[model samples]
Target: MELQKTMQRSLRSEIQKRLKENGYTLSKLSELSGIGTGHLSEMLNSSPSRAITVNQLDAMATAFGHAPGWLYELYPEECLSEGKISRPRLVPYLVRCAEIGRKDCIKAVVSNLLENPKNISILFSVAEQLFQSGKQKESVFFYELVIDNEKDSYSDQFVMSQYRLFRAVQGTNTEENWKAVIRFDSYWKRLPENVQLDALLQLANVCFMMYRWKDVEKYADELRNLATIVYENELLRRTSPKANDLLKTERHLVVYYGQGFLLKAAALKKQRLYEEAKQYIQGYADLGWFEILDETGQQEVEKFRVWAKINSYTLDMMLGNYEILPECITFLEDHPGEIFPALVTIMECANKYGFCIDEVLERFSEYTSYTEDDLNGLSASRHFRFRYQKAIYELQRERFNIGINETLRSLALADKMNHYQDFKQCVSLFEEHRHHASNSQIIAYNKIIEGGTQTNESSVTLVSSSFGIL
Candidate 1:
């Protein structure tokens, strides 16, 4: 009889909790369950006064996973003892809250569970939720707590490494923050080489964000060497029936190799080794390994190609290779809507070599008229550059007011799109042009000053396309 009453209280509490989690008010739930709202209210408020019908209780139980008899046992067990019986049910509710972006709710439930020594899985769930919400610091804290509590769990190492990696990344913009990443890499390297490779890639990204070009190059070289060694070892082994399955599992190795090559190219670009950058980027493009991934990878590879071309054009301009500028322009013309990097390259060439901005603007205008809609679908960075160039063209043609308005509008769009660097550039350009006498003069000056002032802003948060690789 005592057990029966305990079960009733547990069921009632669990039902109420589920309904709240689902955002259903008592009245709403009553309507959905086809029960009188007053009766539902009375039952919930009664505190085990009257026994609920098995059929009605079963309906609620079926939806929330509580037994009918459990709803009747309330008074004697003042507290619902949460043990193995409740932990499983609580996990799904916590997960549901997280899925709906309810971070505070997740925190509340997770905190409650954490206090009860048996709820270890709650820590992992909370860590995952925090990470997804971009709350890396909190994620790491919870993950560390879990690791300290469950030292023998096999997943502890991987979870700890992940937490450390995110912690290091969250502070990457500052030199002091990079130390955490370095520590993470060190810990990861102490693991097996395969595990080390994953950490190495993340470390490379940290180096890139911190603008530690030499470290980026160093890591890329190490990764390449490691990949080559692994490939050779695999080649020397005799094939078994399971070899095909193992080989299939290793397909990610190609992605790792491709990323290493891509990073090496970016490092070269940063060092002003334009030709080297182009060669490496082109090699990755030719390998077509990027195609093995999703659409995001393909877009990223294309963006890298644009970066290579832009740097190549800059190098050519520096070397007085006037012939290359037109070729670059022609290549951009052939690839109509990929205008941002191409525009940057064109501006670099024109600003350095004294190419007529008016002519370039005219060409761009003509190009946009032909492919505006198509180009709109390019990455956000590309879209901003395209609009910026169009605004420049309008300004040059004596459309000062219209040009300012259009440029400001583009800056807002870029901001919404989170193209931080591009948005900053657009803002700077607008501020410069806003003071000009007529819209026509602004347009002329806009062309001449295409590469006007190099703002040291970092790139935007990784777009979905670029994020897949990370």
Candidate 2:
């Protein structure tokens, strides 16, 4: 196969031409670019010129009154050393190209680098370096390259790249989030144990939001078991003292352990298994007794303690224990972040047991009016659920105007989120009470449905445009 050709003029040649044209000596260029004259001389004039670093190249460009990547088209020549890909030159160049939005250069360099299959590892490392430096969006280009070119599915680079791609691809769009989760599901177990714990927890959370209760339970169980194993290994490590090579997780060990129980219980609660969920909730309730509680671990324990109380009250409410209602409200008032989900529970129960929450609804009226920013925050899923439940609660109370409006808002949000279950519920609830809706409400509902259709079409166009990039 023919190696993809690079620019005819070398990076050194371009720099030399630029210097002569501007009548700037090497010493003057070095002073302006913050590079030493001796080093710049070696880079520009050696028999086999020393490779120019990305920072130095950018510096030269700036000193020459050009943009950061002005000489990038000529850089592919620098990435080669006697017809072979040179890692030292290629890696930093590709990263800088991504930083400067030079996809044309990235495509050209990556195509050439892939001709020899062994060069795949260099791309994987480039992806990792970019990711670790918080250039997540830019790193996706190399990660996708790794995924497409990697032939060994079980290789560590292949698995790690898949995991990174999964994490990097998630955004506010629920449909996209779901697709990412599904694509990443099978690979979670193949990741290093530390990452696997975090991945499982994330999977459960996403599934929970999408109302995929069974999948949530599945991931939660895996999380619980793995967290236990990791915790025990940590215990043995503490005792053994063999240089203290700890398995570093993204969060505290206690967090993964607690969340394992917390998620399992939450999923069960969603499935209406109140009694079964209570057992799992108790598992995380008193993690204060857990060994090796660092400050963060202690804080996670307190969080679980709070979650235990919240979930206990939620189960009682679901079981029609309305007598505990006042205390539950008091507890929620103390934890503002928990208020939205608590409200969702309150509304769901009211609709279930034929109770009136007119007072409860009035008390938390401020939270009902969600803003656009809420869609990107921690409570996005809860906010969506709250809208749906509030619509049901209002419709049941015979408040036609408010109910229809809330229904329309929930329907639009669900469609935007690609939350099919909630979307269907909104449609069914509206239809069931269609007789009560005004002419304007009916028209509004029709438009929301029409808008959803258009959004899906636009999404298709976007995915088509994005195909080769991934």
Q: How close is candidate 2 to the true structure, as a TM-score?
A: 0.85
TM-score of 1: 0.55
Q: What would the per-residue lDDT of candidate 2 be over residues 34-150, giving only the tens digit for each residue?
A: 999999989988877777788889999999999988888887777776777778878888888888799998888777789988999989988998888878777888999999999
In order, the Cα lDDT scores of the candidates are: 0.55, 0.79
lDDT of 2: 0.79
* C-alpha lDDT (0 to 100) for residue 34 of candidate 2: 96
| Location of the lowest summed lDDT over 10 successive residues in candidate 1 | 461-470
Residue 441's lDDT within candidate 2 is 86
Candidate 1 shows a clash count of 12
Model 2 stretches astray by more than 4 angstroms: 1-8, 16-42, 45-50, 63-65, 172-182, 243-245, 354-373, 376-378, 432-444, 452-470
